[model samples]
Target: MTSRAIADIRGAENLDDLYRVFNENHLTAGWHKKRSSLWPEPRTSFQPLNWRYAEAAEAMDRAGAWMSTEDAERRNLLMFNPVDDNDYDTVRTLVCAYQMIKPGEYARTHRHTANAMRLILDAEDGVFTVVNGIKLPMRAGDVLLTPNWHWHSHYNEGAANAYWIDVLDVPLVHRLEPMFCENLPGGHQEVTSVPDPEACPFVFGLERMRAELEQAPARADGTRRHRLDIDAHIPTVAVTYIDMPAGGRMAEPRTTASRILAVLSGAGAAQVGERRFEWTRGDVFCVPSWHAFEVQSASPALLLEVSDEPTLSKLGFFIRDPAQPK
Candidate 1:
């Protein structure tokens, strides 16, 4: 339209005139079709994170004293990504947090549509999670899964507090709009089997997993690789272990799935795009989708990695950039 025509539309004297002009242009005020382009270009945000153990532990101690399991249900501090404006999420599709259960405390029995997992950071034999009817002991460095809609509860029988990283696919479920949760009639679920520390296959199995990976064939560059434990029921998420030997480095790889990695042992430096992150034991960091990243160590280093690869693959949205620069 000409400048005069635009001016006339903008200077419409009455609502009827504006409505007539809008109708002539085939437009309505209901919703703008071009809003998507005018809004944020990328729906997802990516921010690198490094949570220190000392600070996290101190915060957990304070939270444990401030809240009771019965009052709060579970004492957890969500790891909010810096790039997120207000969402209490670690990544776009995942919610990662640290949870603390003090001795003599019990997390109420509950189940939800979102799948969940726990990577034990600090715990003793007496601290366990009862899923369905099986009691799975929570030990340091162990990964446990509480699949979707499985009744679960936590109890701490030890003298000290139990800590672990709690991860859930809540954001994804929320987007799908089918999230549902229910509390058990009783406060805690019944334990059908006796609490045994060795019942779960992946509990305290890090050493065995490492040894088995060592025996497997190595890459042409000689770095040991393995995709470790995965929840059979929740196939969309998985845990992997990688060992970087002294003076060895793994090439940066880029993929569609986001990855959250924890340093299980040793020290290393990670290159994520143009940024470099130095990490040691107990340190946690993340690599968002499509960002090329590499891990190198001056000494043997073990890393525990978690990702939503299965879900991406199932939806046929998974892609890996083999040409990503090292």
Candidate 2:
């Protein structure tokens, strides 16, 4: 199409109009966000955070180490919503503080059963996330996942905090059982990703083991039971990350404890049954207990996930099936 025609298409008035012109495969929820200022009101419901996350983050940031409590009331938060928090009848969810740090700062390494994630918000040159000895490069909006139990740490090697969101399965796990933790035992585990001056073993330099696990899932029920993938070290849940390029779709997995997803950047659409929700950079979403879904992304997306892992770790049941497949 000509530039004029393309421009006109980009300026479509509504989703129907946009879809009519570009088709569902090309339509992005974030497309006309600028021109289409507002959209149908979103459902407002319970939203609360896992108190432990807030406490631990603050405590760590306070003494330049780590926090240890879960009471996250109002203090320095910019604009949060009880409706935006992770509020559930069974699982607890919270989007703790979004801290912006200065240069030359390093957060200590730790592990636990509750899964954790760091969504890079902003940063300059030299920001790095060290997970299991791999010091991966960090860029604004680039997401790095630390599968539960992995010894992970981060440093502002650049000149800023390299902001990120901490989404953990804390509340769900703690309620199910005691959350276990340890300080990597020997400080920060050293990574061997230097010599090449371009390799990222700790980031995405796998050859066999990881592939084997994914190929033949660690469990028969499509979910790993009380089996620890990383030897008998840190007890953590099975973790996954979705780097939805400009536009991508992911088939929801089968799980009982339900699941939660957070928008990392760009824009996207989430199909929960017949209803759809448009999301932005900081928008968060919770997939109901066993609600089959197909995540549609408009721009590059970085969404974090969490579930009742500890319960399953205790040899309890945590399985689910499509209520009524689509």
Candidate 3:
């Protein structure tokens, strides 16, 4: 189309008029835009934000008093980004939420195409997640995975409430538009077996993870990290447990990967781009793509980090900023 025709199309007053002009001229709306699709750098609308577990715990207590498993599929509060009208995603390609289950309560069995996992923050004996007929006990510091399309349910048979952090690739699935979900025919599935912890491929038990972390050699900065491929069926996410000693500091180059970190234990401060988040046990935070970030521990800390690095790297979109001298 000519410049004048483009200008006319841009000036269309209504959606119907715009479509009419495009159809008449065999053009797309892309011609009306002045800005180039290609930009100099990565940009994102997601913000760097954090939520304190203390406040979430209080909210959970109030919710438990009024809400029940019968009322909803799960009792959880999302850590939604404070941007635009966004309510479903914590970041661009991932979402994290705090979930709680009261004693004797059961979250019904269901399965979806989106991969999911949980980081137990508070729980006692008798709390378990049954994934595909295997009942796996849930304890604080443990991580349990329920891959895409796997039947899963939660139950709290302990004396006190059970709390945990749930992270999923829901935003990615939503963007790709392959979402599918279904409730179990019955209310719950019968436990067919309880796999031994040593043989169970679906869990990273607390004690076992801790021992592995202790044995893993520390890097030059006195920090240790263990990587796990939590998504076995459809790999889209990666999980890492970082152990930082008191006074340890970690600085990483900016990368084109969105990430969420839940403070599993101890205290630390994170500087993401221009924002600072002081976090302790149970606190959660996000780092948007291409943001420079660093973490410093005031005390020895263990952190559970979830990121979309696998998806980006596999798609050949992953990149890291050039190294700079200190």
Tell me the lDDT of model 1 at 13: 99
Model 2 is weakest, by summed lDDT over 10 consecutive residues, at: 67-76
Question: Where does model 2 exceed 4 Å of error?
Answer: 1-99, 108-115, 130-136, 140-153, 180-255, 271-276, 292-323
TM-scores of the candidates in the order shown: 0.83, 0.48, 0.91
Off by more than 4 A, model 1: 1-44, 195-204, 229-231
Candidate 1 residues 108-196, lDDT tens each? 99999999888888898699898897888887877778889999999999999888888788877888889999999978788897654
Identify the leading candidate in terms of lDDT.
Answer: 3
> lDDT of candidate 2 vs native?
0.51
Sequence-dependent TM-score of model 3: 0.91
lDDT of 2 by residue, 1-326 (tens): 55865776788997677666654345546664437666442222433222222343454367433422113211123223344543323233323344444466565677766655555556788877677776777655444456667777666667544555554556556676867887765455686654332242223222222343355433221221121232232234343444555656766654544455555455777775455777766555656444556777777655555444544645765554545332
Q: Write candidate 3's Cα lDDT for 181-281 as tens digits.
A: 99999879999999896568888987888888898999988999888855465489999999999999988778999999999888989999899979999
* C-alpha local distance difference test of each model: 0.78, 0.51, 0.90
Ranking by TM-score: 3, 1, 2
